[model samples]
Target: IVIGSGDLAAGIADQLRAHPDIGYDVVGIVPETPDPEEGAVSLGEVEDLPRLVREHRVSDILFVGAGHPDRVLGTLLVKLADAPVTIRVLTDLESITLSQGVAEEFLNLPMLRFERRNLVHLRPWLKRVADFLAAAALLVVTFPVQAVLIVAGLLARPALAWEERHDYRGYPHRIPLFHDPGTGWRGALFRALPPLRYLPSLWPILTGALSFVGPYPEEPDENRAMEDWNLILTRLKPGVLDVTSIADHPWVPFRDPAGLNMYYLQHWSIGLDLQIVLKESLRVWDKEEGESRHG
Candidate 1:
């Protein structure tokens, strides 16, 4: 059954009607509309998906809506989990490739079967091991520099800045970082040291609330306003560093921030995490070198 009644859904129906050899019937659209296209039936609202599936003897479902998948695809899956139906999701090419969805080209139109799977399900323990080790090592190595910066900041400013941010699971936690409360050059100098800003983030990683490499933390308000796909990202631990900063360099190709995080979620592995860490370290070193030479 076609799950939408918009232009894309109508277009797909038109193409399917033209291709007789494809051997598939055009089922009615869902989320009952007052104005369905010519010769198309309107099934009940999305909440009645299961009943419609049974009544129509639906063998397949094509979700062609441009709405967020959490509301569109998620609602359908919850009701039709046990139903025998082949579901195809229409999404962008990047999401299709990252998700490992089966790709098809019909009349030069890209089609992908949307079967969502947790990419890191099999290696949670391994990821925890890596997070613990990396967090511990970073804390040890950076403690002296952090101490010096803390002392200096305390002497110049009344208090250090502590930002309250939400993690992947929407849990609130305070992260310590240097913020210039417009206290002149001393506060500016404190903010210039990137290592000092990330020292307190090690606590979350050590305590198992975060990973050494994962999605960046979002503010509570920002997290609430995110789209369905971005909300999925909050399921993974937030990291101190993100791929976006590294990818932002002139030499590195620009990537969509959300797409890059989604890519990491779908293709996560211990080895991939290590590679990202190494690249991030190098990027930081190059940045520091350029700053020293220029500043």
Candidate 2:
């Protein structure tokens, strides 16, 4: 639907009608003054844009007519803020250059495009959504085992206390380590079940405190390999699993040397996370097979 007033409105409508190959079918016009002589049927008034869009099932709306002066365009845009339609508003080239807008030249005129919220860029957001879904699934799979361990750990408080750490953006967070204090054979036993030990981390990932990939959170006062590298790494949400953690012995004191952690951060993506997980899984499978052969 085109929203405009006067002969200029007729000219814009004529241009749109002649250019059917441009991939738009102008159903009608929404004129400020009801015109019986107008070629396109009047849809409605400018104030009724949202309702008219819904009633006419409008997928494209343009503000090219003189009735839509730039001063009132902002208010009109706000009215259709949530409308599921592509909005094109005629604006000066300088305005498009100064502000973030999708502009295109048509008929020697600049038109700025506004799209629905759902169609925005999906790069980093894609990873965040994936992390949430993956963490939720992990919780569903590990909940039963975690419940039993929680009961036992409660019986033995000395198993390990919650460790405090700093996550992305320097936000302080606490995580379960399930660290056995090396006081008894029971400690050794719990340490042997590595998967059970880190199962608690899925809850944090689901809560947005962590991710399935990225640097592990460091202790509050732990020394960093390079202050700059450590500062840069904190930009990402801390994860329970990282290549450094996966490659090292499960029982060894975990350390995120700057070089390796930086590499993971530099090339970070969903694909890198999946590759690390696959590599670790294969390592465990190989270890188990070797043990079985020896036994």
Backbone atom clashes (below 3 Å) for every candidate: 0, 0
Off by over 4 Å in 1: 1-125, 144-159, 163-174, 178-197, 216-232, 245-254
lDDT of each model, Cα atoms only? 0.64, 0.60
lDDT tens digits by residue: candidate 1, 1-295: 7776555566566657556567778767774234545335566677777898898888988876666445766776788899988887766343434345567787896555557675433255677888899889988998887677667778776446777555554466666666555546654554354455557778878998766676654445643567556656665566655555434332221244554565555566777787777777666667866775797
Report the alpha-carbon TM-score of model 2 versus the true structure: 0.39
Please give each candidate's TM-score.
0.45, 0.39
lDDT of 2 by residue, 1-295 (tens): 8776655455556656666776777877777556676535677666777787778788987765544455346656788778778876644231112123566787996666654443212244566788888878888987886676677677876444576555643356678756555546445544454345566777787888877666654455555454554565665676555556433332211133543454454445677677676666566656645764686
Where in model 2 is the C-alpha error above 4 Å? Answer: 1-122, 158-160, 163-173, 179-192, 216-235, 243-267, 278-295
Candidate 1: RMSD to truth? 13.8
Clashing pairs in 2: none
Q: What is the Cα-based TM-score of model 1?
A: 0.45
